[model samples]
Target: MNQESQKSVEYSQYYNLECRVADQVKAKQYNGALESLLNFITLVMHRQYPPGELIGSAKLDRLCEKIGLSFYHEFYGNIVHRDEFCSNDDVSVIICTGLFKSGGTSPLIGDIVRAQGRRKSTILATNSLGSMSGDDLAMSRLGEVNANIIICDKGNLVDRLHWLVQQITRLEPSRIILLNHHQDSVIIAAARPFTEKTKVLFYHHADHNLCLGVHLTGAIHVDIHNVGFCNCRDREQVADNFYVPMTINDLGSDFVRRVFLDKRRLTTCSSANPHKFSNFYFYPYHELIIDRLEARNGFHIHIGVMPESALQHMHHKMLERSIDPSRLVYIPWTPSLWKALIDNSVDLFIGSFPIGGARTAIEVMGAGVPMLMHENYLTRFHSSRDIAYPDHFLWQYPHEFTEVISNITFDDLQAHGMRSRDYYLKYHCTEKIGLEDELNRICDGTSTTRPAPLYPHHPDMLDRSLHFSYLEDMAIGHSIQHDRATHVAPVAAPLTPHQSVSLSLTQKTSKVIGLLTARTYRNALSLIPWLTKR
Candidate 1:
């Protein structure tokens, strides 16, 4: 089939699924409908199925809200757990996530625990959390400080979910903060009925995607930055939406970095996991790096896991362009990504493309290295807009990125680095990232009467059909890779895809869109209304 025909098929598939979901709801089969909704989301997200003119977050959020309400209404008293447990007063907040030993929301979860004291917080690690980060990096211990909570990886999807629900029943925490993988229907299903006693907060870390937790009943969707707050708030969804200033808590280590520049060649560095460096950017991220390096006889230090194949591809591409591939050196996963950048005396740093890495960007900026994020969808996507907008490091087009980085000198680095540091201190510093007030308000059932200012979507924001073929090409087939649609998220430093070293080298894992396993497949069965699907 031609490109247009392909897109039409995807659109039709989604439309039929949407209708099926509605039928299920009308018939009051909420769990089956919820399962169907999840399938619809994955098809849209990874496969880029354009169901309409725009793939907006609110589309499925409204459905999720509807299904969640119906399910909670019918099944609140019938909730079950795998095990019965005694209550523990120590559990005040449950930090739930898929199996990510480091990076992603682990640090933020740690910050939440630190705020209330570690003893009052519990980390409920689900089976979907895969890809362990660096063993030595203290951030892997949820960012320099230590926080070991409960582990809930008992059984398959259903069993683990039941296990999670039972933990909540026993502990009865005052609040349950979700730093979950977005497409986790299990987390959504498990936590749906518990909102009466415990407040559920959807911390919008991965605000760009259509995840399961957006508009559930009794849940408050908290956007960490202004752009996210504006985008989601303008769209209609059932949940109570609010904005909170984003923050990160670390060990508060005092360290100073000095950029040791070798007068002739400019050394640039990027620390985002290689997955963030995909074709989704304006130009391929490797091409962007190569152009910047070739312009001034420069060198670049990359401080994350780069698959052997990607490394060879860059080598071949560099040789074809008549630039030495040696100019681009790939360093294995460094314990300290920002420190590696600073220690290498990098004159300039580039943020990960498409999905910008705000967590690491803040760290590098705080360390006083000049950095900029490649921007396309500003207000539409969850980015570091609270800081990178108006005056800071945002390059909108490829030509602009080339022009800026090509002419940058050490003096430029120092000046821009100083300005970037100023932005960091003014906005994201630890003292500034307090959620206590927001927490208290959430607990008290207080909400802002003010609505968010309307921000129009970027012209290039909606893809007619966004092709994500580059993802599977990299051979990232670890477990739970598709659980949150994480291959497309604002990724943490991907030490290795799903923490499997050799798997990153080979390309054998079946795509999440396979025949029997795909949610899209389940979507087809939901069309029957009373199919009683899992």
Candidate 2:
């Protein structure tokens, strides 16, 4: 073959591999997806450089950009880049995400935009085109708020980074908000040089243990829950950290009353990821609740985002406990379908154990469905507790939880459900939280600023052994011993630019290793069925 033809063929292989990874991600086969991505990166690097040559940040960035662009095109088709719209507009806030999915950070952006009166200039920046069904549904929902959505088409990390930096620099956004852990490094790196001119905020949406050693120094940190703020404060001192509780659009009095009064078959639901229940320790709690609910004549449980294998395992566990399997039902998750279920069928929303469901719980409450949560010490974020639902809705022991489920009368459901709705309206309403005011403060330099932590100067600022052990205990099914060390102390100073870059590099390296390990485990699991069939 001619050299040009050979090059074209190799590039096509990489593009095909990226397409497969995007499909896998959409299918929720994340481990397999990561494996494919890592392999693609390795091959591209090898092709570009001689063997044993160290890959630098510039090359790595270029490779990531190439992969991101291929994935975007494969998923989204040939859509024109909306650079002109974003660049010329006077954008007040910029929210960045790797993908625009139905859950997590995307919805939060929608809420913020909705709360800000929809007139404020806001941008929803994403890396990929997003899954047609799910992402489009999410976009439609966010579209209600009328925010400009921009997807990066630049191939390779460097170009994408430059593109993002250019948008920020050109638009001169008052503040920039990053959505999740996945987009942290690239966004932070791109924004670091411009930090003095603009306020950048990283919102911590998950447990801190999952992303230890992240360089959050250059930007301010925004914790969705107070617990998350405390967690960040305890780990690394930043310029400033804000506790902005997540708010949703109120479902209104009519919907609240209707859902409260609807007394038919009792349906309990959860929209959390199914893998959360895959751990041996947490699955039993779900089974126990389902079993107790099944014993009652009118009660049933509906769970979304659960795979068939996990459902089967839970069913088997229920059977072992002499609980009827018929009560437990698995529902596939889609934005519209889940909302329909919430509005019409769901009676009680059950929050996930160990790691509480913040967004899901808020969503259920916003839809006027009362939620029941176990107040466990192991939960990384006490979202249930933070929401301050009535004491009757919070359970500590297994028997107590079962009793609450069994004894809940029609009146009790109505009263509790209304209370939840009221609480959501008062506390979680977008206007109530003053998102606009906060953004204004951030933009004008009136926002509170604490001394940033100098990690090199203060060694204690980097230590998280106790926190790691606590998370380790939760992961392994061991009981967590809550103590004074868990409390958030006043943060020390901030890290220097050099220190920040070093920390970010360290985290990126650690993430690469973590991804490899996870991919290996998934590959091994895939082998189990083959071995069993033999």
Candidate 3:
């Protein structure tokens, strides 16, 4: 068949499968619904590699628009523009974030900025805005705090930089805080003309190795975590940076009480991305620990927000190692993920190696769950060693992890969990951390001596910089290599003829049922004489 005809057939098949899934859901046949859903996903996966591309496509956006799936369209669509830029020169502070995703230190920083009672305008990068919505926790929190939010339009890097420059020039704020190094180059370029007017602050949330390309000389490097700040300060390039630890604003007294009061299971949870496990870096240690845990009764691992493909890879690895997959539970991404973690009675929270879980670690501790993390040189700048309570677990070697896991009893876990919660309250809580004071000091022209470059300058250092693009490429390459190493292909083969036919029949039946139901409703309405008279 021609391309057009093939696409038409594919659309028809997709629509039919969707109808079948809806019917199954309505009839409470969840298993059947799941099977149909999987078949639909398989079809989509075959058509689109990486899965993310499906959501990013214009065709999918158009289809969503035609189908009145506003939420889906908003979420999946590439371009996100929020033209809330206030021309008022009264705005003193401009808090700019590179990515729009709900995670990261941006939301926390935004919350702190708002709490400081300063006239501020927040700008979100276009790429980040695609993943956000009006109801998103970060957006809602910003709204509640009355921070003016501006989402940039999607464009090429140069176009985005020009737009950002235009916005910054227009706003003419006294202080500008760049959330991460992803947009440092743009922000630096934008503020170059207005360097004397606005003091730019670069908040380093990730490790220095991850952001080597970022030119820190132009901006005031502010490390939020103590150890992270120390690590950055020790570096010659970022030595003169300020230290302002993260403050958890949403943690209330009642929340703390609930955390301490709640009874939980011996289940362990990790919100780390499965891609972090793709390489043999930490997987061997993880496998060793998991095997030991599973050998004992009443122990389970609940992984959060792992992709289906990654989960499958992990399951296969477990099986290859003679481990049981039944003990491992995969939790998909959801808005109420914190509630889900608590409700599932996750007692112990685990952190990934090389790159530690910063936000997740704070959250798990705040929820009164003890966390254990493996620290290495790569994670020295962003590890749990500094933020976590002394009682909380941190291991450098595999044997250390095994020993910690083996000796810890239920009572010990509870004690450590409580300590972790207290540690969060004392150090990380917004009420305790004097973020406003530090922000005000910076805004008030409190100048600090600039530090020298830690590492010798290299001609090709910029290209080697572990920016998001570089990291993504590395992750993709690692995934491909890891898959090959395990003898797994990137994409699975097509379904059998029997499976396709069964799915098709389910769809056809569902369409018939839907038609019958619509017809019956129309007939009932036609039978009403009063309705006809009206």
Highest-scoring model, TM-score: 1
Clash pairs (backbone) in predicted model 3: 100-128, 224-245, 236-452, 236-453, 236-454, 237-453, 237-454
TM-score, prediction 2: 0.61
lDDT of 2 at 531: 26
lDDT of 2 by residue, 1-534 (tens): 677766534456646765675576466443344345444443333222111122122333333334434444443324434342232223456556443444456667776666454345556453421223434444544536666666664444434544665566556665566663332334544555444555566666644233311344456666676555554566444335665678665545544534533455667766655434432222244555555555454445454456566577668877887767777766555554236545556777777654456667666666667777765433434324555455437655556667777777788878877777776776666656576676556545476622212111111211223323423433332112223345544242222222122222112322212223233333334433332232
lDDT (10s digit) by residue, model 3, range 1-534: 677766534457657766665575455443354344334433443233211112112222222222222321233223332233333334644544333323455556565566556466555453211233444435333324555556664543334445665566567675666663321223433444343345666666634232321233356666666555555545434546676666666445444323322343356666654334322232232454465454443345544444465567557867887677776776645443345557667666667544455666666667767878755433343344556666467665556666666666777776887887887776667777666776666555473422222221122222223222333444466568768898976554444321234332112211212223223323333333332122
Worst 10 residues of 3 by lDDT: 49-58
Candidate 2 backbone collisions, by pair: 61-157, 65-156, 65-157, 66-156, 452-493, 452-494, 453-493, 453-494, 453-495, 454-494
lDDT of 2: 0.50
In model 1, the runs with Cα more than 4 Å from the true position are 1-35, 49-90, 101-103, 129-141, 144-148, 236-240, 249-260, 280-282, 377-386, 445-534
Order of models, best TM-score first:
1, 2, 3
Cα lDDT of model 1 by residue, 1-534, tens digit = 677766534456557767877898789765456557554554455433221112245556556656655654564445543233333445565546543433456656656666654346766766433323344234353654344466664444445555676677767776777766655555666676666555677776755555666666667777766666655655544345776655544323343345535677778787655445542322456666766776767788877667677688778878988998888978866656656765677777777664456677667766767776654442334334344523455566566777787666667666777776666666656676455655557556684633224333343443212223322332244224553565554332312222132321001111223222233322333332221111
Candidate 2 vs candidate 3, lDDT winner? 2
Which window of 10 residues has the lowest lDDT sum in candidate 2?
Answer: 454-463
